[model samples]
Target: MTLQPTLPARVEKDRTTPPRSGPSRRRDSRYEALTGYLFVAPAVVLFLVMGLYTVGYGFTLSFAKWNGFAPNWEWVGLDNYKDLLWRDPVYAPRVRHAAANTIWVMVAAPVLTVVVSFPLAVLLNQVKRFQGVLRSVYFLPYVTSGVAVFFAWQYILQPDGAINSLLSGLGLGSLQQPQGWLGNPSTAMPTMIMITVWGHVPVAMLLYLTGLQGIDRSILEASELDGAGWWRTNMSVVWPLVRPITAIVLLLNLREALQGFQTFLVMTNGGPGDHTNVLGLEAYRLAFLKNLSPTLGLASALGWLLFAAALVLALINLRALRSKT
Candidate 1:
């Protein structure tokens, strides 16, 4: 009985339904965009004021000679850059030494970190009991206070420190360093490299562990079924799958090595005759530690040079990764 009017009622309802207005939709989109801009405005303003402005100011300052309290910045043109290159004899050798040490750290630290951390990650991944506890333990040093850790390490590497004590107890007293690991020119750089590697291992391990967990169990099982041993499977199959993670770890390690000087500063202070000097420490010394004769211009120039080197190396890394892909 109701079917008699159903078709007419449906048609009427359809005709009466309001069409979506283009202006309304456009307004809604604009509103959303405005809201997004408002939310991000604070961050953008802060970056421009704090980061970009300071960077630009530093670049300008790099072209001028300025003691920290000078009434006016003395225009020096490219003199600061030239000084770092070869012009200033005192500055030139220090820069060269720091540059060499920086390069060594950049290359050695990342490689050692990767070599040490990946295996630890694999082992940790296989752990079934107290996995969380073990992971926390490994990561603890990374989260600990850097100054405290550096001091602890400094104590540990001292002449009569625990390491030498242990060496003596093991009847390897001949191998012990009486000058302390950090004080000896021969051992200082290597010891610093090892400490850098140690500091980075936890991060790399965590990354690898996450990557390993994300891998398909079926692929692993199939590899085992195909008579592949653990090492073989991991090296051949697992490593390839975890290349992305490896890249991240390598980049982070490289950045840290290139930019970090805190550990060396705290532990060695570029001592043993500049054996552990790095670019970052040199820059810091130039900028702040010069007392009344602050070479802020030279420090800024060095900072820019360091930035350029880091950019080049990072670009190379990215290019290599892309080509692999």
Candidate 2:
């Protein structure tokens, strides 16, 4: 009494639908390729004009003295490089001082970023309730406007500002700087380093968190079951596994510390009498802000020197990371 409908063993092809011919396929592919190129054309053109062209021009300009506006560029050969590298008495000493300061920052910032951020990231990864809120809070600094935050920090580090007031309230009044933190040459550099670390920690922590999340939960559990403590599990197991992330964070922070001048420009303007002056600010100062006598060639030479140092350090880091891996 029951009728069961049986399905067809083979479904018939649609004879009315023609397969795409070779020429049509090729034409479609060509159209797709053209569309993709058109999509990227603006970015490619911009890079050619603003990035490569500017770099080439800067490289060429390094050998010529120009006020950045003059029609005639005086070809100075290697004089600009020589002066910055220790030929001119005035420029050489400043350059050396800036180089030293730059090196200090370049080494310290990335190290501190790792030291602070990794611990914070580990702790954050363990967080459960309100985790999203906490992460957003941590990430705020990275997303916040740099100039505004730097200005706020400048205010906070001032003599009568919140930091000094807090110190006084805590009965650490002796530690309070009457001349303001940034006003004192002794404290200026360290304070800036601290700010840099604080600003950088968020991004580094986020990277570490991402790396930590990618780790297998079973691996962590196995480590725990094998009588490994939290510290040992993280140090010996987790940290090693997160080496790639750590390398990325370190390289990024290193590059930033090497090339950054915005914070110094905003907060101290390379002052407390050049105590916080770095090669980045020095280059900027030479190119644009040296009492209307902008040494465009000298600035370009300094910029190239900075570029060389960055390239060498990057290569060294990559090599070391590869060796470890």
Candidate 3:
């Protein structure tokens, strides 16, 4: 929520309460808020110390020249950021490539996840027997460790792996040699998106189930009595009330999708002509891989840039949703 210039009331209570006690209540409330802050003082202090150190140190470093090693450096105010934003050859292309890939995956994967999960969630909600088992089956992929899934996918997507073997049995020639799923640049990102959606479906399913169940049972029965079909009920009733949850899902999905990394790391490693590079990879490369020296500056700039992107996108999505409502 956007804060107004003046702080809004922290709490809303009985406005109709007698005026006689108003002065006393305000004094009491002030003490309560003060005590609450005192109770959380240690946490607040710890958070500020670490957060300020990291952000401030990075911002200061961005204006200097240094490798990833010792802090021995000289101020080069805004040079690195300029290079990254406007001049640097490798940096510009890397950011652009990463942004493109991130946009593509973020756009497609969440929509796919939500679309596929809705019917599954609706069906699960209607089930009476082994409902928990059915949900677990759908959600198993989400709980499986990335390392295990990566290895399993690697084998399944290999040329002579299970997928190709099955394809061959059906007279579909073995996948063109060398690489399988992550082999081709064109397909690597798409495959990652598909795998991501497969594992990520549960979150959307959970959201939809919550929304569906939140609908008043009487309202549903009334709609049914009016002869509304499943599709009609879902579209006109469930979706309207679930708008906030939809926004929540999209916000989370966008973040997860844009920042997805493990799959690319284990599967593609930003290979096949750097097709899978994204903002997350850019941060990794700047901080860890291509360090000229004292990489604090570059890493900090990239971090701030990512923060800005996230903030701007979140606000835009929020505003769009609010306008629709």
TM-score against native, each model: 0.91, 0.90, 0.82
Residue-level lDDT of model 3, residues 1-325, one tens digit each, is: 9976986868878779566488888999999999999999998898889998867887787788677666478788887788777788867777777888989888998788878888788888899999889888887888889889988997898767887777777886755434676787767888888887887898788888878887789988888999999999988877778778777878888888666677777777787788887777777777887646555567667777777877887999989887988
Record all residue pairs in model 2 with backbone atoms less than 3 Å apart, i.e. clashing.
none
Superposed by TM-score, candidate 1 places the C-alpha of residue 188 at a distance from the truth, in angstroms, of: 0.9
Question: Which ten residues in a row are the worst by lDDT in model 3?
Answer: 172-181
1 or 2, greater by TM-score: 1
Model 3 ranges with Cα > 4 A deviation:
1-39, 174-178, 291-295
RMSD of 3: 12.6
Which candidate ranks first by TM-score, i.e. highest? 1
Candidate 1 RMSD to the real structure: 3.0
Residues 111-230 of candidate 2: C-alpha lDDT, one tens digit per residue: 999999998999999998898999999999999999999989989999999999999999999999999999999999999999999999999999999999889999999999999999
- Write down the lDDT that model 1 would get: 0.93
- Against the reference, the lDDT scores of all candidates come to 0.93, 0.93, 0.80
Instruction: List the RMSD of every prediction in angstroms.
Output: 3.0, 3.7, 12.6
**Clashes by residue pair, model 1:** none
